[model samples]
Target: MDTLHIVCPACQTTNRVRNDQLGAHPDCGRCKQPLFQGRPVVLDEAAFERQRTRSELPLLVDFWAPWCGPCRMMAPAYEQAAALLEPHMRVAKLDTEQAQALAGRLNIRSIPTLALFVGGREVARQPGALTRADDIVRWARSQLATA
Candidate 1:
């Protein structure tokens, strides 16, 4: 069976998981913490880069500022989407307010932007809030499908 490198959200350790075991509730080799938490992991610039570059799985990032009302409104929906997408992909949130340089590097011009990454490269980007979980999932999946 093929294996993939998954970055542990808890410990930042890299683990190898079999292709067939992705949905089997795999644990991190180093931290023994569940790899898929069914929720989005909060990320800093370093953590974001590590997961993006190291993991074989696709990454969905929500870039938002704390003061942005649209971002606050979309948080719950993003959380719901995380629950649905985990085990197949990794979901994370990056606070653009805290990581201004990183946000600038990504050219994030708007709050509540969603970017999907595959193999360390951005595959698609959507700006503005997606207030529904289904919409977020549908958009991410569509982008991944095309990628």
Candidate 2:
């Protein structure tokens, strides 16, 4: 069986999880928290800083706002993309409205934007909401290949 390396969201401890168990409730080896939670784990400044530096897998961050229609539409696609790319990439969502400071610091100019970060460096960004899951997944896969 194939396995994937994951950095625990709670403890930041690295865990090796079986690929087949990804869809199931895989627990962190250190903290015993569920690993494949559907929602994007919200990160604060320190957690974001730590994740950007320590995550071995690629990261796909969705910058969105709650009231934006397009952002709402894109939420499901983001979730689907996350499920598809698990064990290979880490998917996170940042509420630009809530995380305005970070958004401004990152120079985010749009409501629904997708950013791909690898090894703590942002490699690519796309503005506007994605209409399809394939588009999001394709972009992330390209980033993974090029990174």
Model 1 lDDT vs. the true structure? 0.95
Once fitted onto the true fold, the runs of candidate 1 whose alpha carbons sit more than 4 angstroms away are: none
Tens-digit lDDT track of model 2 for 5-99: 67777787778878777667788988899765755766666667667777666778888888999999998888888877875677888887777
Model 2 per-residue lDDT at 120: 87
- Candidate 1 structure quality by residue, lDDT tens digits, 1-147: 799999999999999999999989999998899999999999999999999999999999999988999999999999999999998989999999899999999999988899999999999999999999999999999999999
Reference-based lDDT, residue 19, model 2: 74
Deviation from truth (RMSD, Å), model 1: 0.7
lDDT winner: 1
Error of 1 at 141 (Å): 0.4
TM, every model: 0.98, 0.82
- Per-residue lDDT, model 2, residue 143, is 73
